[model samples]
Target chain A: MEDRFEISLLLDFYGNLLTPKQKTIMELYYNEDLSLGEIAEINDTSRQAIHDLTKRCYKLLLNYEEKLSLLSKYNIREEKYKIALEDIKDRFKLSDEAINYINKLFEDINNS
Target chain B: MEDRFEISLLLDFYGNLLTPKQKTIMELYYNEDLSLGEIAEINDTSRQAIHDLTKRCYKLLLNYEEKLSLLSKYNIREEKYKIALEDIKDRFKLSDEAINYINKLFEDINNS
Candidate 1:
């Protein structure tokens, strides 16, 4: 996967692990399309505090992603699976015998 | 945005909103690079339960994304901000006066 996609996935996963306040602020700012000032007013926090929290949360998320690489590994495995599936489909189209063999093979694989 | 990118973002966001057990299964299967049997062994759950939970979580996440579109909206906004930043950077090298004006403008924008 591309670095940007990896970063986005990491951020999404890390964001879920944050505290409710942090999650709410992130959701309001990034997901809810709220301005900093608007979020500060609604949450009854100072604008500077909100900004600081947002910055800190972003840094934390990036750090977690760098250390764990969870999302990157997941993407790689997923890509591998997709390629395997496509290859099987291609083989299936080449011969009816291949199709039945592949189907049975997949069932066996799943059962095992 | 491309459909694949949108779908991936939606899945990531929706995954965040899932129950801890569902999230744990997803992380194990997708992020931890574990097989269903391996995950079942580690979680001390039946293989069928793990399989069922994983399938259910995937469908639930997709449905939530379809209903909310939170991640898609966030991605669009992020793209707009990135484009704006790039445009400002491009303008910066064209003229020193423009550079200073844009820098000041950005400061004002941030301050506001």
Candidate 2:
């Protein structure tokens, strides 16, 4: 729950790997921030079942992250881009417009 | 079989997600280019079992790739870097040494 944003990010990377049910439940609980009882009621399942499904989804997401490290790789790539941009700015003495454009591009990438 | 290199690259991204047995089979078949019969004999399994395991591994790897698209993302990133490098080279007029260093870095990334 504390790492809800991180979990959502992981879901972005590996959500398609999940079953439809798992993906739906994840969207309900994490994206919609639904209570277990609310989700269970909506899905016509017991609260306990909803809880269990959520736990399984968490475990599965963690497992995928652990194995693939796509999230980590992404963070690393972002960091590298930042460093490269800085290097270019310093070494090449890029113009303000050029730096601004580069910053905008990086912002678009990070948003995406 | 035809996309052996592609399969190997997929395995690189998601190999650790597989069961140890699956990883071993993939390493034997893809990395070592071992025959199915040879792998079966060494692993004390039938050729059919080896064949089935490999097929499952392929399916699982493909599933991961389809879901995560990390391989595709990596390709896109590399392409972006190439374009960015070219843009910088043309606009900033970086030194030949800088261009060579950047090319070497990209080569390292591609090899990795």
Candidate 3:
């Protein structure tokens, strides 16, 4: 089965908005690595129905992500964290003042 | 009038969710620096009503912010941007590889 990583990320972010049935179908299809035929049989439905529902669920999740952009914002934050951590860890041995300045910058951000 | 910067930021973020009249009142009170009396007279309402309504709108916006957290996420993103720019510009005399790496990190974030 193909690895549907993007949809998995979207699911993690917006899965709560999906109906339980739709969400289950998605989890089975993407997360559980179940074939659509197996999922349909488990749900006592046709393979075609599972296929369509999964597609619709994917679109719905995408729509939610597009409007709110919570996923994109989250990814950006992660990137920033990774970059800052790597930079401070690997390079730029600095004085106590510079270290404190960096620490204070993040402290103020967290407080805000 | 004492500066109410926080409400102004909240209004910018969650203002669209508010009722039209509520939005107008908030904008007038915070953006236009109008007194409650001035706003009440303009709307042909009691000053006390305007005062209470503005207070209510403030709480409503706060609730929206608390639940969605769009504002806090935005602040964190801004802090990251400011730090990255300051890091690249004010401090780090970087090699081409380091500059390219940082640029790629942000570009990937923007693309995502």
Candidate 4:
């Protein structure tokens, strides 16, 4: 529950890799911020079962992140774009419009 | 198969999402250019089984690509960077070093 934010981000990168049951539990638990009892009620399962699945789903997301590091790769790409933008700004009279467009390009990158 | 090239490219994006056995079969069948009989011999599975798995693996990759579209996102990012670089070149007296660094940033993006 405390790590909901991290799990939500991981869900974006690896959620499709999860089983349908696992994906639903994760969306309910992390994205929707539902309580275990609430998720269990919706899924017609026991609170304890929901708790275990939430835990297992969290672990599965972590395991995929560890193996693939897609999230880290994404962050690194963001960082590189940020630094390149800064470097361009520092190195020249790069126009504000140009910089803004570059920012927009990165926004496009993320929207994908 | 003629699709060996396409599968190899997809492998870079969705390889980790595959099961261990599927991953091996794909690497062998596509990357190593192994025939179905060869893959079957290596895995000690029947040719029919290997054939079925390879077809299923390719379809699985296509399904993931369709759902996630990570590879398409990647191509769009590359295209965006290329356009941004060109726009900067056209808009300003941006240094060669700066442009080179921008290209380098994209290379890093792909390496990730």
Clashes per prediction? 0, 0, 0, 0
- List candidate 4 stretches off by more than 4 Å: A19-21, A93-97, B19-21, B38-49, B93-97
lDDT of 1 by residue, B1-112 (tens): 2244443444566655677777877777776668999999988989999989877777776665554444554455345434544554463333545335434433332222
lDDT string for model 3 (A1-112, tens) is 4349989988876776677788888998888999999999999989999999998999888887776666776666566745664575466454555555555554444333
- What is the TM-score, restricted to chain A, for candidate 4? 0.92
Question: In candidate 3 chain B, where is summed lDDT lowest over 10 consecutive residues?
Answer: B103-112
lDDT of 4 by residue, B59-84 (tens): 98888788777778788878877887
Per-residue alpha-carbon lDDT of candidate 4 for residues A1-112, written as tens digits (9 for 90 to 100): 3576878999998898788888988898888888989988988989999898878888888987886787888888788778877886777667798788767876676556
Candidate 3 at A17: error in angstroms?
Answer: 0.7
Output the better candidate (3/4) by DockQ.
Answer: 4
| Residue A36 error, candidate 3, Å | 0.7
In candidate 1 the C-alpha lDDT for residue A93 amounts to 36
For model 3, how does the per-residue alpha-carbon lDDT over B1-112 read when each residue is reduced to its tens digit? 4247988988987786677889999999999999999999999999999999988998887886776666676667566755664575466465666556555554454333
Candidate 2 vs candidate 3: the DockQ winner is 2
TM-score of 4: 0.80
Which lDDT values do the candidates have, in the order given?
Answer: 0.59, 0.79, 0.73, 0.81
Better of 2 and 3 by TM-score: 2
Using lDDT as the measure, the top candidate is 4
Reference-based lDDT, residue B100, model 3:
62
The C-alpha RMSD in Å for every predicted model, in order, reads 21.3, 2.8, 9.3, 3.0
Ranking by lDDT: 4, 2, 3, 1
TM-score of each predicted structure versus truth: 0.38, 0.83, 0.47, 0.80
DockQ of each: 0.02, 0.42, 0.09, 0.44
Name the TM-score of candidate 3: 0.47
Model 1 CAPRI quality: incorrect
